[model samples]
Target: MHHHAFSRRSAGIHSLPVELLTRIFVLGSQFEYLYEDSPFLLKPVQDYSPAEAPNLQVIVSHVCRHWRQVALRTPSLWTTLHFRKISHIQRATMYLSRCSLSGTSNTYLLDILIDTVAEEDYLPGINLYKNELRTIFQAIVPHVRRWRAFHLKICDDDCKAQARQYLSACGPAPSLETLQLYHFTDYRTAQRLYLATYRPPVIVFSNTLPRLKNVSLIGVNLPWDKSPFLQDLHHLELALHLDNIRTPYAYWDRMLRLSPELRTLCLHYSGPKEATAADPALIWPNLDDKIQLRSLQELSVTDLDPDYLCQVIQRLHIPNVNKLTLDLPDQNFTPFVELLTNSAATGSTDNTGRASNTQASSRFHPMEHSSPSTTPPDSPILSLRNLETLIVRALECSPSSLISLLRATQALRVLQVDFSRVGGGLCQIFNQDPGITPSAASLASTGFVHHPLLPLLKIMKVAGTPGKDILNTLHTRHRLSREPPAVSEKWIIGWDEKRRGTDAELDALVDKGYWSFTGQGRKVRVIIETYDDEEEVEEVPDNDAESGDDDELEDEP
Candidate 1:
């Protein structure tokens, strides 16, 4: 009976049109790459092994005669090549040869990933050497013109030197669009010791990549003035850059000006050097003349120096940013707060099509809008009118500043905050009663008004358990509203096991049906997730990559 069912299913799939079947095979081969919150680091879920990787084309070609014909003819299925072990060199060559024989007129572009980092249990009694990597690079370097995306991961110093040699030796890559190079080493320790031996400079394709739009480099340096691929990039990420080989401020300014079409920019402890009088050659931009990044949508700056971060933020004019992530140190949020305050004072539009500064003052009687003393007509304004999602880590700001920031961003839909580093005063805003009157002490001290905050919020994720205050806010928003309530759809709370007794009130609220509102076929969901500690919880990163133990890959043979 099982064999009959399998045969019937197989017949149904085989009866589809040839074009549709080929597309299905092509779509099935594509996989998503997962990264950590820090964009440069890949999520290390398990040990790297070549045998565990997915090979969708090989599986479909070995299934049956009809399926094999369709799979062999689909050229897109053989574009991605993975080389992690010495044994995989043969497989990479096989993929290239299969693409040529797929009966296509034009040459297919390749997306190659070469990981030279050795794992202990990958292959017993065998280690990947420099010559093995060179052999693999030599085989693919000949087809540099047909490369679309190239990713290289090296752990050893010797392999780094060889990779740089091969990259410099290659000629122009006209079709290359994405380039990523990662050195798996702790850059913090290296920076502390000023160790220049482990961190080597990388020069790719001899500055000949014209079509490159996405670039990610971690623990590597490139001569910024000589590289041509750094301009007009759609996505650029640089992390863990050493101070000894820092790029000057002038080059950094020029690069940002050239990349006007950038959509995503992530600078994690990397960018220009700090502005100091000691380096007279490092010319800083004037406050009035800012580099306009009108097309940028997503921006991330993590682990940057506070003074330098302020200088960088003041020099850019980003008006359409919708998603922002900041992982800064405590008491380092003044710059961002000033941006929000200035945006509100400059009469930026709110969600209600009114000036945010006026709306904020009219909605709350006690709160006042404080504008800067001096105003310039042509000053660059960083507007948060279109901001929808915000994620902040290690945020520590005053209550008034936080209030002004929240008022400016009335269109926020999703908010994620690390409450472990926040002060008690900031958390009180979440518990503010929207229906009740404000007390005399509250109005005098914090000038907080009993008004609804973040009315359009749909999802909220808190890194620490927010006990009864969060519950009170949610209940008030749902039950005590004159107009239609904009209650959040989902609230995810990360509970620490150490705070077991403190979450009793939160548990009681959930037991009671505070979230079971049936208004216009809408209901709220509250998710309580428990974790051991910060280190243990952070170790398990996002699993957005293709699963290694997939049933389809296992059943291919």
Candidate 2:
């Protein structure tokens, strides 16, 4: 009855050696099909290719049959897919199915990009893909238990609303640990999701999340009155666009009420600068004693006012906080800087070894060290003797004042100052005593530094036109103290030719024997022999004219 069918087995696969089997399992497990040449996930041949992203994967497959099978089985290598277009979505999903975590009974984690912000800006491009958002969400929404991570960005408000409605309808994410809502059009969907089923004395989460660990709000604002919906999160990031409309400080006051398991909190104060802006922290009545951020260890801030920034630092007793970063305001307020450093509760805090070293690295930085005259920050103002990394940004400061700042720091090792910050109103500074200017004047400690000085100072950075003079001054100090020439040899004085320094040339600085290399470092470093710009008037010329006038006067008489 019949022609029997014969199935050809891979020749060596049946009797493959144990070592070969293990290597093949490792290779197949590690190999990602998306990295291989298939119509589904093909990448352009270039220096940077996804094929290269899976370099180790593709190479192992060719090593042997066993290796190829092993490389094909690894889920971690197959996890993330960059769905550039609608057409690629179905194909990427097919490949992702191979790494399905059903075997591990764990959800697979994937980073998906439906549309980029810039891509949404183009009209035709958005119209082409606008409808795909709903379709894609529909497919993935049902498998919510499998979703380890999801980010959907759609520009069309209608599409965004649909996506939001679907997610808000999906109920609470039990397996979902990470959620990022970027460019969300309708926040009310979330508002209703968190508040609709519950009412408040506003204690939102009650035996809430056991798995949800991280949540970030970017370009999203929660109601000033709304409490945080996620409970027991290990990390929280909040980046807000306040529409310049100041919300109540009690809004933030609510976040502090959470379980102290929180390790990192990134909060930003953003709102439109309304016709008049109000300070929320000052107005909040309950803020008087809520300073304890129980489990919070690290804090980061950006583009905030000096006063409010200080209030946050002073209020929060972050015992585990060993790292601090300050993006100094243009106003150059150091007291504000000091408030942030005060957050580190020293002595009571033992951050010795790695922790203490990290604390040591975060100290104040001098504006310029290679300059003939050094200018730096007033360290007592920042009060971070335990700081580890000090990053000073564009600083346009008077030479004498900056030098005073450097002299004040007792633990400064790394210093950076970019002269670009010298705002145009600079003419306004010199006309008045520079030390009296707003930034330098009001600092709790005067820009005039008074300290034994940092003994561990190292790594000096200064850039921009104005830095030239300051850098030269620093080099002179280094030379005298034999400061081991920490500066780069290629550090030419005139690196920044754009600003071109001042109308009045630099006055010479004389040392014990060596002629001081003075003058702004940007232009020709005018190595002067002596400090004389004025010549003495010859007495002989004056005397000859006086005698001639006297003789003429006698003749006339």
Candidate 3:
């Protein structure tokens, strides 16, 4: 009895006025799909009421009576028919006729999205309306030319081509500003069958999309680069993979040369797939440096190592490319740093004065350490003066190793070193074999002095366990520790400690304000003392109790 009463009360509440209920009910728009209760009862077959069906068109009808009339009045809403609506086309056509009563002068667009495009499912299920859909597209596609945007995305190329058969029924579309084709059929059979007869470039040469601004071709082939005459393209992403075309030097040159107005050019190649495997002599040709790209701004490339890519960048000499994304798999830290040598330091610039327009300001100074180094000879030479942010991911750096790297760069502002050095160190290399530690000795013996880098570098962010001296030397500013007063004791302590320092070298190091440290037991802690203008002094820690005990024992004896 209570459950029945609750149900009755809920039903009465749900019966509230449509104006008050519409807001709460509109939540259904956010949901992507609708599901039926079960297989038990024959699921309620959607009645496909053109007027009552939940759709973008009908949803607008509920906005208000004015919108109801206007929404029902626009043919565009009714023209774009979904494939699922075939179940109620008769009722849909009736609703669409009234919706678009404004006539073909207003024009309209129709779009359909489907789950699968298998020939078996398509031929039998949609064959009944295939002719009708084709007729509608033929009528709409040609007349809707002047519209700002018209798009049709279909998985099955057969359905689209079949729909295009009716194109003869419509006139040329003039006002279309945007047209998008995605997941277009590979049409492999047609590609091979029509390759010999393909004359698409000929047709496209005369047909131009004067206003087309964006083109994205993923895994699509270009019969010829000369066509697809896009005059105002602002962005382009043409994915190339495993292109074994060894002499592609001309391919991109031609493409960029043709697209003079392009602002952003992004190229992604998944492989070094040679276009001509038989031609070993076919070296990757260098780009023409004199080639001028007027409007190009940014360039993004992925899946290539630093050494080869740096060479490519040097050859391209794009003055406009400001931002670069290096997504290559760099196993060794050497290559990435080498490329840092090529960063535009001074005058390197595109014709547009973009970030890539900066030029080199300094010579590449090799470090004097000349130790058995971990870096390679062929690493790219990079300059960091113009570089702002550099993100190095992957585990290939440690504190000591990075100290060697940081000492080589000048313009580095933000540096991040993740924990790649745990349980490893230069000392470990010496422990494995004593021969590795003598590189510093070799340089010292040879009297070779090479200044690594300038102290202008700041803002170093390091992760992982770091050595105390390594961190303190490169990071923190030095500070003096205070001690209790005791003039004679301080002198004696200083005298004892000074005994280890040869007077001459000690004096020189002190004259240069050398910072020194004392080790305790086996630990790496430093013994420090404060300084004042009064006089030179050093004080040891208090051990009075032990001293008193010793004096008492000596007296008893």
Candidate 4:
């Protein structure tokens, strides 16, 4: 009798205001998804199994009658529609209706994400897949005017052709702000399709997207000159083969000129999957005028022809850039390193002023037949005075070049070097030169014989087993922090499991607590008597109390 009375007196959650309940539902819908700010290729339905119900809104609505009413009325909750399967058209249609406030007025802008790949659960036929894509794409066509952010990842030419037709049918996209289109297919398939039909599939959104600020096009052909899509962009990512675009560099320079507000740019070469005899030889673009980026902060160039990359870097003037990342071939590193080394050195701009036109052209020459190491000596010096961070990946950079580069960057604070792609020992190369030894190469050195490098460097993150001097230098830095009262420095190193057997010095450092084990340890089997050893060796803890403690080092005077 007492329990029954208590239940009767308590109020239920449904009695809360609808506005508060709507906010609660929105918060609850914040689930985890992998496709955040990066390109994602949608997998098959079997991969997404233990499948989520057809409609998430319906699932939430069916919880109670009050929830049903509240969810159906919340237009914001239905604005984003992600289609993981081809048969999700029913749920999409339901969402389209609910996203609208009234009978005729579609007040809310939509963000659409579609993955047009057939799954194992669907019937096994190419025609069926094409048909499903057509039906869904047609349904979404009427609402193209309201799209604010549209991302599409499709795999075939038929789908691309169909999408082109739909986009051409739609008029101006005034509300659009971000657009990403990715085509995930091998170059062989694209080549065969191209051979069958002499022309490539192109989508021309002429003067449609005015407010667009961020755009990413991966393997999608577009008529860049004819469209207004390149104007006023702040973030742009392009991954396409040079053969696919006739005048790639002209379009790039024009985009830079039109958008002085551009901040981050990533350019990656997407060559054909397999080489073809008919593929045309690459012709370097003529860059006579220099492009200036006043507001740019970060730039990344990957998998590009070394000569072209050097040409582009030489022709651009970026005074305020803070971070630069490079991932290119090892043979291409010489000219790039030379350029960077000169850029980071003091008084490089003054040198550029005194440089001759012939010298400048020779320095920026497209080294068509010669190697990067054989470039002329009369190159103009550039300056990257504002650069603070540098990241290098998948390139075998020599120790001398790296040391030279570091010496030039007086303002650099963070350095990241990835040696996973190198075929040999990292320590053997860097430690041979005692002149640039880490302990002696202090930025405070100001004499005739010694010169300091990496003056403001505070953080060093290296991947691979380096030599003992590298460890000693880090240790010395840690010891010097006490007298000057410097901020606590951090050094992170990652080495491969295969290196464990051969890198004795690395093991000693790990034992000494100068470095810690962070990566996945290999599985081993151990036995007391007659069996093979396969057990994880116990990791040694950082012993600060026993010896070589931070307090043991003398304070710097």
Top lDDT hit: 1
Worst 10 residues of 4 by lDDT: 524-533
Task: Between candidates 1 and 2, name the one with more favorable TM-score.
Answer: 1
| Model 2: per-residue Cα lDDT at residue 60 | 49
Alpha-carbon local distance difference test for all models: 0.63, 0.41, 0.37, 0.55
lDDT of 2 by residue, 1-557 (tens): 13332234434365667566656555664455442322112111111112212334434445565555554566554554443344445544544664575675254555444543223344443222545566666656555665554544443445545555676566544565656554433334666434322222222123233466766655544344443455566666655445332334444444554545877665554422222124433243211233355466456565666544544444344544433433444654454432333323321111111112211122211121121111111111123444433444433334444444444343555554444553322222212233332322333344433121344645434444343244334333333231223222222222322322441232122222223221222222222222211223322112222221221222231
Candidate number achieving the greatest TM-score relative to the actual structure: 1
**Candidate 1 — worst ten consecutive residues by lDDT sum?**
364-373
- Model 4 TM-score, 2 decimals: 0.68
Instruction: Give all candidate RMSDs, comma-separated.
Output: 9.1, 23.9, 25.3, 14.2
- lDDT for 141 in candidate 4 is 73
lDDT tens per residue, model 4, 22-117: 887876654523234332222211122111312344456656767877887888667766554543565567678778777634578877777665
Alpha-carbon runs more than 4 Å astray in model 1:
1-11, 31-55, 85-87, 102-106, 118-132, 186-202, 343-381, 425-427, 432-450, 495-502, 506-513, 516-557
- Candidate 4's displacement at residue 502, Å, is 8.3
Off by over 4 Å in 4: 1-15, 27-64, 103-105, 118-129, 189-203, 244-248, 270-288, 344-385, 409-414, 422-461, 466-473, 480-486, 489-557
Identify the superior model by TM-score, candidate 1 or candidate 3.
1
Residue-wise C-alpha lDDT for candidate 1, range 504-534, written one tens digit per residue: 9755644453553533545655444443435
- What local lDDT does model 3 show for residue 347? 24
